[model samples]
Target: MYSSLRSLADDTFCLRLQRAARVWRKVSDEELSNLNLSEATTTPLWLINKLGEGLRQRTLAEHMGLEGQSLVRLLDQLESAGLVVRRDDPSDRRAKALYLTDAGRKLAEQAELVVRKIRARLLDGVPAEHLAIVDGVFDKIITAAID
Candidate 1:
């Protein structure tokens, strides 16, 4: 039945996602080991590096699919390491905007290089033309998941 087929497909997709996530985590851990940063700290650093200044921690947390408490814990680590700082929002005293320190920016750039290299290695044998489709599929998957 179509319903069963759909369920099967969903399960397969989730399994593949988990596998890929595990691989990514392992690669990141190995690559970032020299920095003495944990996965939790690295996550916010990566997000802040991408979003830059003026982004709210809560909003960024939602975008990254993390719950509030988890995000707070991550932010605490990043703050303690002097990699990021939270400033009082001009419009809302209760809200805070995240900013990356110069040190954070330098580390983020290095981390990006590691990610790019790992991605390139993973896609090494794939045809160049297929990259567009691969990117499209990832976009579609993210959109669908969000929706």
Candidate 2:
């Protein structure tokens, strides 16, 4: 009986975490849309900018937890918008290196600001100690999942 109760509690905790993730993504997407970006594009752009111009698509996709084809589509759109460029990798002729264009860099900066504001709003009432605990819990969760 005790084991069953523990299992139920664990399940409920997982469900709550999933629900929170969904809500956060939905809200983020809506906010990003106003800046002519989607949840998909904003993170990639920001990461590319931070990672520097010669970052590989595969690396970016891995960091973003996306499949290759999905990342390709996002890159296609970004390229068409003149926000990103896929340059031929000097070391590997077949591979393309990802780089943000001038426009992309500008947008990335703005995206950073937007993200900061959004994070502030989302964490407004949360106490620092609570946030630290949550952060630690997430770190453990991610580590466990990865292993």
Q: Best by lDDT, which number?
A: 2
Model 1: lowest-lDDT 10 consecutive positions: 34-43
| Total clashing pairs for each candidate | 0, 0
lDDT of 1 by residue, 68-119 (tens): 8888888888888888899998888899999999998888777777777877
TM match of model 2 to true structure: 0.88
Tens digits of per-residue lDDT, candidate 2, 7-111, equal: 999999999999988887887888888789977789899999998889998999888878899999999999999999999999998889998989999999988
TM-score, structure 1 vs. true: 0.80
- Local distance difference test, candidate 1: 0.81
- Candidate 1: stretches off by over 4 Å: 1-10
Residue 144 displacement in candidate 2 (angstroms): 3.1
Which one is best on TM-score?
2
